[model samples]
Target: MIRDKSFYKFFVILVISLAFQNLLVYGVNLADNLMLGAYSEKALSGSALCNQIQFLLQMLVVGAGEGAVVLGSQYWGKKDLKPIPHIIGVTLRFGVGIAAILFVIVFVAPTQVLGILTNDQIVIAEGVKYLRIICFTYIIFTTTNILTASLRAVGIVAIGYLVSAATLCINICLNTCLIFGNFGFPELGIEGAAYATLVSRCVELLIVIFYLKYREHQLNLTLKKLLFIDTSYVKDYIRVSLPVLLNQAQWGIAQMIQTAILGHLGAAAIAANSIAVIVFQVISVAAYGAASAAGITVGKTIGENNIEKLHEIVHTLQIIFLGIGIISGTLIFLVSSPILEVYHISAEAKVLAKQFMCVLAVTTVGTAYQMACDNGIIRGGGDTSFSMKMNLISMWGIIVPLSAIAAFVIKTPPVVVFALLKSDQIYKILPVVIHLRKWNWVKKVTRAEI
Candidate 1:
């Protein structure tokens, strides 16, 4: 129903850029998965387990950055640029501290940590080898993500995809040469994959720095600005950001738990789950991009006090989200078989993976709609606590417990347990729809002066 041409233009640009950027980021992981899968099934399983830790770190760092974006976008809306640097500073301090802590833990107890995910000694050993090298990229990745998020809050999204493209290319080429020992290079196997990712992280950081220093003019950010944050904004930042942090952390931990449940099933289950997840992650980029764009748009809209257009915007976005969900689901369903064929896993693993993807294909529709609505519209409007509460209830209270019971007690099929784990995407729709109608999620997070 929305008729504004400029709105469509802005939304389209942001969605395409952010989606491509996300695609490239996942493309790096896809490269790792593909290369490792070809090397050996053991190598792929081990690296997949190690990547779970990386995924957890990503969630935490992204949670921190998103908190800043929520605030920064509002400030950017008012054309008030002074407080944003402080917001970035607050974000960096928390983000880096988290990265450092995780690095120490991972470096200190690589085997013990991987043990929590699966009991397979072979898989754990492979994971440990990959973890030792890949863990080093944590801090570097965090810094780049937070910086990129700062740009995104102000509607500058092209840099993110561009940097990711460079990283993807570097990762793929290195993975090819190092993983296979091609062109006289020493074959590092799983170790080579870890090294390739580590190098890509460093290069990604450099690219982000170059762009910030030379290309970006709005914030004119300096090392000084990052080092000396206004302490006054710390409390405000925590107040708005803590819930989001906890939400993401809990969500990340929940995913690990899900992995652990499936990991206990067998190596085939672990390998299958990993393959299915990568495909879903790649194809769902558009859905995620829509959520990110929605957050920025809704946050900026509230900051501008353009409440009049809010209803139209939300309605129109819902339609777009539904369409995106259908297309994403179809793509996942169509590509599931061909993608499975590329993996050098057992036939049993391939069959299980296909089943998982089928489940994801159906759940993705609910995910696209509910994720965009909750994350983009509600949380983006400054009601961060809602999602925190909703996730706690749905994930912990319902999905996790039921899935655990199904997987362990009832001895359900792996596919059934996975469906239970993802059922939140569907059941949450009613509550989210009800809450959106109430309109209480709209709150201006910006202050008169910092």
Candidate 2:
């Protein structure tokens, strides 16, 4: 059943779809940085801090989506249509609830939320404005992503890519027009960026709805069915998905602390770190895409009862990912100077950014292996709970304490502190490599649905 050409076809399509989606999503981020950075450094730092909450919430939704994929891919592989609705229903239920809670918290207590991330009054005030306006976008974002993740589960990756690209283009155009009053547009500045995001999210939701109606014929999803509470599937989804949600949420929290540390370091540090992060994320699109594709492919293989091919597929992917890790790391290093040149940041910030970029480029080599295998191959084999534990252990246990010390106690340079903060990637490599040899990860998750 696992033909080389056919698998490659699936691999390439999903990789492109997911990679392009990352490019578009992060490209909008780059635009935000450009527009906001040009507007004011304090504003840029403010928005960056506010977006941390967004990142935290997105991780929760993505965790739910990952649950959908884990179940949906297996069902799709088994050619069973019955369980798809239940899995999606559970995912949507969680996504909607999280989005609503996030919206209320950000909208009602904007300053309170912003205050937690940064100590600067200017950044807090600016971030409050962005948070209040951007809160409205969370619901649509969460729901749309759940739907798209389910689609990706069934090998329908293009729609998400197209939808994201279209929305990002709109977001950037609106950002340009509104942020600077270009083409006779009002110069809303910070408010303008928030409005652009709000408008783009609205369009993104509508486009996703349209795609589901016209293109997702096989899923045959209805508003009633998606909203219908399947207690059984909800339980099952939680049983498997909670760890992932916690893994991401906890990881997000720890990462937030790292952000807070950087935020406190100075506005220059925030801007420099922000630029470096955006660039690294762009380069990382390929690895992330491959990870998702591998998950889907391995999940399908497991459901179809192709154990031998499953092993073969994973082993091959490991080698390929390691190679990608090396090349991507090298590539980021080679181009760092040019990339930094394009940014309008100060000489000081650029100097800091280049140093951090060096650490990122080097760490990406380890990242490729750890992320691809951890999120992809192992979890696809129905071992998410273990994956979750691994993350918690690595991040909270090791990354957090060391980062605190690096930033607080050692009082080292920003780049060295950053390198210490990112040491988790290096630390995780050994554990992941060891775990891959074990047989416990290959459990079949597609028993008859309740």
Candidate 3:
């Protein structure tokens, strides 16, 4: 019980720090969407569609960062700081390579990707312009993610929150000036949002690079480190990262499919669903950040072979997430209407968003549970294979099919489809609960001959 209390105290701090970090990411997103919607309704939908491609790319980058956290936490536990450079180098190399390829696709074939998301000519034109302006931002954004993830792995979570705050401020200032034609800047409209994002990302990259130079011990980036390709370390990184990458791809594609389904309902549904998702993500990232912190802390503990405290820590983290989930979800439900007003969507769309948010509010606990157990506890324990398999079954086998049935066979409303899509979270809880209780996840993964 004493151990539980101690863990809870630490977890509370983690949650608070993560809330600030998420404030930066989500705050920028909120302001970006509002500025787009307020300036031009078409821009809102267009940016929404363009962001689908960007979102998939981001998932890949974030997955690499996640892999970085997994390795860095365990490596830090073992006091193996020597290999930190190699790990960062390998992750960044692979990430940058992938981002280059994606950038080509976005630049060379922007319309082709937009076509997959929508058929509206106006949306397609705006989305194409948005993609063209923002494609270069991927390189900068990917680097920021890798650097931030490496820092977090070394217990520098506060820096990430600070960076996020800085990014939010820069993004807002640039967006306002560029979007609204302030300070004699041409009113670039929707395209201005893209340019603002691009400029802000560059600034974020510069900050991260400057910080890395000053704090070289925390980050081990060097010319030789970047040039020297260690096959063995690369192999280990791939072994753990591939499944996670696949999991993210599967989850992201499934979401795109769900979005396409919502698209068929009407433009209003698309706009409303997009608005609601951004709002919910702001709330959700708090829990997400906490879970990320938990995974790192737990992985560090297991690295030291402190097996006795594992279960207590996991339980405490789970409880912390539960309380956050409940309270946050309830607030979301109560203020759903006011929140909807922030978006200039239709009245019908607002109603649908409110109902969908209510359902999301009720399911937050389940979502939080999965984040702590599956994402933090299991993956932190080096059970990546199991985590991948579970997401495959839950997202692909259950959620996709159910969403399709709701959309096609039942011809349900978008709200109903959105609700059905959330079933994966509910269905996933049982396996996570069973897995957590077994305590097999307590073993140290660093000694597994990586």
Candidate 4:
């Protein structure tokens, strides 16, 4: 919203970085499934179920990161780094605590944890093995994600992608080596994927720490500073962050429930959905990039008090988002048929995948707008409470119930149920457009802080 040509450069850089970040993370999941599918369809379904639970944690980490981004980005945008350390401290406190609890639960009751997701015995057995091995990643992910989001808040956007790229390379190499017993390693099968993820996460944390240390002065961050906290700053950060945390936490749990519902239909449905989800992520990478850039753009605009730029930025972003949604959705539709022939999956799963993909292609249009407005424009502008309500109203108020009814009560087709699960994307479209026109989010969140 700063309208300077340089602002566009920053936006483009952040978008590309965020897109790549999502790709690297989700690409790892896709790769794991591909490799495991080659091992066995049961292994693929089993690991995918485990990853869904892991995805919930990832969303929690992202929630904490979003809070840090909302506060830290706004403060940094105002050229005052006073609140950054305290915000990180508070976010990590919650994130680390959640990670610890999840670890304990998964460690102590691996069967129960995996059991909640699936009913198939073979998939459940593999999922239990995967869960036990991967639970350690929760805490690692908590710390790493907080740092990544916090760094991005302060204009170190590309660093996250660099770190993810390196980590992914390690993950891929490890997966190939351990999963298949290459390089004289034992064939660990599905469990090998978990080991690879754990090792890569550890390496990722170390890399993030070293990078932050090297640039600490430039970003005004330090170990002591990260460890320290100011009560007033804590309160301020909490006030602005609670809604964001709730938004993601609630949204994540709902998504997990949706996944569980799919899982219950049998391993075949779960496997099909997993493949479809991977394809959706691959095609929708640009939307993620755009959403990430939107947040930074809005936060910078508010921090800099560039009110005149609001109308122009909002209108232009909406146009760009519309195009992104349409283009990505088309890409998904175009590739689904060809992709099925290549992936190692059954005829039944392939048929279901095609059905699920058609739904994804259409729903992605609404999803693009929802992400752009809610994540980018609204949350970035410090309108997190508004976005939270929209998220809850759309998902809980609409999608969840519809999905439940479609999947259980009416016992509809898997594709119909999938469409119902995605209804929130459609529900959010017009509301976001209406809200953007009002310009309520244009107010500066950093005015009082500075």
Query: Candidate 3's residue-wise lDDT over 381-445, tens digit each?
Result: 87777777888887777788888888889898777888888866677888888988887766554
Task: Put down candidate 4 lDDT per residue, 76-141, tens digits, no spaces.
Answer: 778887667888888888889888988998899988887888789899998888888999989988
- Local distance difference test, each candidate: 0.93, 0.84, 0.78, 0.83
- The alpha-carbon RMSD values of the candidates against the true structure, listed in the order shown, are 0.8, 1.7, 1.9, 1.7
Kindly list the per-residue Cα lDDT of model 1 for residues 1-450, writing each as its tens digit: 789899999999999999999999999999999989989989999999998999999999878998898999999888898999999999999999999999999999999999999999999999999999999999999999999988899998999999999999999999999999998899999999999999999999999989988999999888999999889899889988999999999999999999999999889999998999999999999999999999999999988889989889999999999999999999999999999878899988999999999999999999999989998999888999888899999888998899989999999999999899889999888989999999999988899763
Q: Best-fitting candidate, measured by TM-score?
A: 1
Better of 2 and 4 by lDDT: 2
Q: What is the lDDT of residue 293 in candidate 3?
A: 78
1 versus 4: better TM-score goes to: 1
Each candidate structure's TM-score, on Cα atoms with residue i matched to residue i, is 0.99, 0.97, 0.95, 0.96
* Model 3 poorest ten-residue lDDT run: 441-450
> In terms of TM-score, how similar is model 4 to the real structure?
0.96
Clashing pairs in 2: none
Alpha-carbon lDDT of model 2: 0.84
Question: Candidate 3 has what TM-score?
Answer: 0.95
Q: Higher TM-score: candidate 2 or 3?
A: 2
lDDT of 2 by residue, 1-450 (tens): 335887777787888889889788878777888788888787888888877888888888888899889888888889986888888888888889988988888888888877776678888888888888888889988988899898888888878888888888998999999988999999988889999998888888898888887777888888887877566777778876887888878877877888888877777888888888888888988888889989999899988989888877888889878888998898889888988766667788899989988999989988988989999998887888776788778777787788778887988788887898887777788888889888678877676642
